[model samples]
Target: MTDDQAYAGTAEGQGPVQIDEELARHLDNKRTELFEEFEIRDTFPDDVLIEAKNATQDPEADIEEELESGDRVDCRDLTTCTIDPVDAQDFDDAISIERLDDGRYHLWVHIADVTHYVHPGSEMWEEAVKRGNTVYLPAYTIHMLPPVLAETVCSLVPNEDRLAHTVEMKIDPETLSYEEIDIYKSVIHSDERLTYKQAEKRLDDETAELHDELTLVHELADKLHEQRKEDGSLVLNPARDRAHTIIEECMLKANKAVTHELQWVRGLEAMFRVHPQPTPQEWDKALREIQELDGVSIPGDAWDDPRKAVNATLEQAPGRQLNKIQWAVMKVMPRAKYMSDPFGGHHALNFEIYGHFTSPIRRLSDLVNHWIIYQNEGPEDHDLAELCDHASARQKAGETCERLYKQFLQEVGLDPHAVNARGLEVVEDEEDAELTEEEADTESAELDL
Candidate 1:
């Protein structure tokens, strides 16, 4: 076909022709290419799979018995539940709250005890350390553990008796300060599994099952959230529902509690998720740029106090440009990473120490923390600094991979404005010339947008 014929059915004869099937095939090919280019591993090695299978089938594998034997609390009676994404396969964390006779709130956060099966020097451990964390793609995931453990044994599914590392906190109802904090192994039976959507609905409907429990937990979480805000924690406000806020507050408290226990009580060193605060010069540069670009003036206290900074800037920024402003601010701040130094606080959260303790099924750093919490011993053979560096690097690589994949999908999807914003260059198909006028008009209209 002639060039004119090939370009005949484009946007006002200016852009490329549109075909759904062709775009799908092109995207699939691009996905394969990017995966190979990035060397993203899709499956576990034979040895890792074999070891995982044996660990699963071992007759003496009695996690529930082990959890029941020791200082591990039997918290199965608590009206516990998990709130996660609707399609989540691994329920790694669940929560429960109780009211003491003194009107204090007793909160229990249970995280999947993956270290129970995967130990040091094992194939599973080796693979997990190498992978660092699960890489979530749009349609699939590259899990840190094999499917047998990630989906079955270590998954904290509802109604299943499972071993978990629990963080129990007693908070004064008025202050939301921890009255007491305890961390130990525990056995928990999650009473129900609700997605974020379901939890939001339950919050709105008082007649829903576990509505009272959800309400109590949510109220406490709100208080905790307000406390964090007062503490100058940097919060990136997204379109988060109430259920998301509740889950986030509970998990943040649990992570902080675990970090506190490890560093203070046991004097054991573990990998911590740390974010360094911005220097005065860095903050000034960011503030200048934001003011120059958006004409928004952020106060000096906003730099000194992150909560004020976020609140003050968001108040001035237009609703449509909030994300853009946040991105600019993030660019000015140092990135968060895993650090072996327990004293290095998380600047973003405004915590003296913080950790990734809630999702061992997905994060290797959490698994390391779990081993330290449960075994009362750090990894003897490995260098803590080296592990932190490697884990942080792997986590960054996984995040980049996921972001690129999503950007590719957006470029090919039915959103011309997004594609343009993503700066995708359109390549003309050479041989395909036949297209209807309706298709051409549609393509033209989409591109013109």
Candidate 2:
């Protein structure tokens, strides 16, 4: 049965009942019950634990050696910084901006070099591959890599000389045109770590430390945003805050730059983060639903030119209804995923080619991209299609786990002690099932809703 139908029980020969308080309570109860009953993989297996321990052993020595021998660019003098959540432990990406003598903007994006430590075919790599990505819970996180590696050695903390896969792009300050792209290994020292809350203050405050750099980054991002709009990119603001835009734009540029370099310059076999174009039928259905449900008038050519249509619809929508409409549209859309064939491109970003080269500490695809970018080892030996499929499945699982955990929190208010003690037991039946191919497929299909 569909989730809606299963949750809000249907009368004989009737459709799913409309949401009411009773339905809400009933759903909440069911979620709590499921939280207790569901076969949740809360922790790593003993084998994984042993493997992670081995991988993290002698981390200090490993890091020091890599720093000495690895390709390095001294970007310590650059006004680089990290913007993330206040409670974030691992700062995986950092950004810096400078005006070149030619009046073009030099934007530098440095991503944590997790692959430098987690070598191919190593125990940590195996663990990362199995977990796929970090499962971020509201209260805790199940990291893909052990904390020794993900939280410390590879984290781009301030003032630390960390190995990084760097993307340096020179863009015209006037035209916002990307003039040159350079991808290489580098060592960077972050000057500051600003949370989104702190970053919002720097928007117009000229006296802010690194104010000039922040302003340049913001302006470059704004220009790049306008350029993306011109390219017919579908702009979806999941986080509406302006401060978030600075980080988002920088990361997008880095990912896009890496993908473009791999596809055109290196000619290496690589995996990409691709978003297929929404089918005309899917677009039409979403618009029809919005019109019928909210009585909002969407542009007639929304399906033909989605970027314009969506913006116009949002403009017409009331501020409160904006999120509702966006959510509805997103529900009907296909999920973005990883792929071996870089030619698929990313329709949502309006990029001719795109890949996830940042956040290797969290994502396996990014780690693979780093390997291809730095080590010149393509994912050719691995079954690209299978790897992509596994990564996508793991990502979906993480999302599902997180969603369910949120529901649990809503049902039972924030009492950390109670929540922690409640479901500490592992399901004996499922504990041995370490996300095999068949199991992943079944779980992913179940959570596809």
Candidate 3:
């Protein structure tokens, strides 16, 4: 039977029910469960990981012709700037601040010159394209770029001279928003490297040895964060939720920051991560749940008191039944995911343009985003058809690997105390027998939703 029908056998007939969200995850977890110490070759086809890794291990694109490397691109020295966690080795991005005619600050987002290092079909490039991007592990990392480039040459480290795609925008002090933006190739001279903590400290107190420019960047980040948060973008507190929440928060920050002058100056760019609003069915369910609750009036509009009405109800009926309700509340909001924006329209960000510019040091999709911005300027085509497909495919593969790995981690790291005391167990039975590919397919088709 299909997972949906199987769930129906046990619970309410509500399509495919996720039995245990935290413990019970994607369907593929079954595969990893069988082979904890997985060897990619043994479980999956040889072409799965090796083929991609070898294919793009080195990029073959002609640098002098396609890329604006030497003196051809905008090479304004911005080495005085530094980025990342206090002791970050990979510098994917840097910022430059300048005063303009109206005394407004012209902020420049300088992304690492990745195109200069990785080109299409190259071993490294193809591997990156195949790998899609760097996968950050709990304690290690599967980088998109080799240490030679990602951590050193193309890292955008302070005091280093490197090529860049500079997105210069005029910021209004009063609004703390961008008035105008310009994107182009440029060189930079970073004055000093600053960490998030160090920068925040400077903002909290003056004369704390923090550079003036560092303080300004933090302030600008706040303004940008506020502007986006006001636009329906949910930036949650990681501490209040789970580990994945932090990842979501950091990625959202990067996604917001990525919409620099180059990718978003003129038109709406695509968003790689978006969770569109809930569906009508889900909204209806939520309304019914609220209406039936004790002393709760049927909200005229679910969007009106989403935080209060929706969240409060979920809190009250915090059980298996509430999971569906939570999902329905999500339906009422718009989804912000990977879609090609026509004119840089990020409806969720409420901005005309947006792109994933940050985290290029690890993500190939961001690299492709850089390529898109580059080609749009004067190049004939952005080659998005191939790049987008590669990005999507790689993203899927990376997710599969990460999922399997996490399942392995979960299985290996199960708490003995919790398992015995709280009654969590791993039991194998004939009914739960491992299904072959064909059997699984047949079993799924046997059941109708």
Candidate 4:
């Protein structure tokens, strides 16, 4: 082929029509180089693939039968709304707002009733428990539920009926505080599904007829957001993480102090993913940095308290280095894992109770919480040693899978010559330049760890 013809006329690599019999052969090959090169799906034999997903299965027949029968028990016909990302499939949280007669308001956080779908001891529940958490890969999602349960059954699809358990908190608009709260078993049909981007836009746009309730709901959430910030919450400024959502921080931040009541208490054991406080060495460095910058010293010991000294440090020295010190201290703390004891919650939230009740269809904790709440009136079993152990194992497995997938992305994303690793191309500031190109390259190439 000539230079232009190379990419043109359905010949070699031109005009996107690079296909030929040999090219097609490799491109369609699922298991080998073709799939890896063309970004096709993973290929394993049927039985092997089934074994890979050996964890996922449908709920027991009896449970589904009960749910089918309970279909008649629909909830208030009032309009409900599902708020999530535009591309979100696991629609687990819905919201409703009620204006009270005496100027108070009720904000309802309705989570998907996964227990009604994946009952305890059922195959689906077993799979979900074994998976521990949904794998949110960039290219695809490894879900805890089949599409039936995730996108259809439990999803709060707009205008479609869905089962849910609602947590309604009475709020004083002036104080932005929950006066009293009530949790209920209810069925709801969403009137609309709004993305955060869209919802915020509606609130910002003057010409749009924004719902009074949505305005109030955002107002309340903003107030809550502001209050928490003022309280010295460990606000993250992501360094090396995805730009979209900074999803990890976003979820944790969004749910902060939102559902403390549902968090396990009094030995109703759970997996509390806690982080231990920073070590003395790190704290000493933090103290030094604070003294150097702000002429102040933070009490490192305060980090061990259930109430984190994050706010104190923020008040005294809220610089990047101080934030790193707090993060280091936060890292030193034990990682929160599944446990049966009612341990204190995250120090940053300053709430004794809390749990991940938002995404049941995607998290084992949410599923377990759903199970626990279903039997909320049942006799207490404060600790769940065996359950917690199993949960931790499953969590480790999920993490392994997710990390491997990200590594795979890096492998694919890198230049063919540099496929084995990634590195930064640092452009040091001119004023701070202290190294020649050779020195910089040598230093950058050194593996610190």
TM-score of each: 0.83, 0.79, 0.59, 0.64
Tens-digit lDDT track of model 3 for 82-133: 5344325587766666666887876777777687656655555655655566
| lDDT (tens digit, per residue) of candidate 1 on 23-123 | 65776686677667666667799999999988888422475457546766788898899987654678899999988999999999999878878999998
What is the lDDT for 90 in model 4?
Answer: 72
Candidate order by decreasing TM-score: 1, 2, 4, 3
Best-matching candidate per TM-score:
1
- RMSD versus native structure for model 2: 11.4
The collision pairs in model 1 are none
Best by lDDT: 1
Identify the runs in model 2 with alpha carbons over 4 angstroms from their true place. Answer: 1-41, 44-70, 292-295, 299-303, 379-381, 414-449
Error of 2 at 300 (Å): 6.5
Error of 3 at 139 (Å): 1.8
lDDT per prediction? Answer: 0.75, 0.69, 0.49, 0.51
Candidate 2 per-residue lDDT over residues 1-449, each given as its tens digit: 52112212222233221233443455456545543443334466676667667766775575567667855776777878888765466788999888889889899999998877676667677778878888766436678877877888788887777778889999877777579998878878887777676677777678778778887788888777767766777665533466677887888888878878888887877778777777888877777776664546777766467655665676676655666667666866678888888776777776778888878998889888898888676644567678888898888777776777655554433322222222122233433312111111011111010
**CA lDDT for candidate 4:** 0.51
> Pairing residues by index, what is the TM-score of model 4?
0.64
> What 10-residue stretch in candidate 4 is worst by lDDT?
440-449
Give per-residue CA lDDT, model 4, range 201-239, as digits (tens): 556666653356567666565555456555544443322
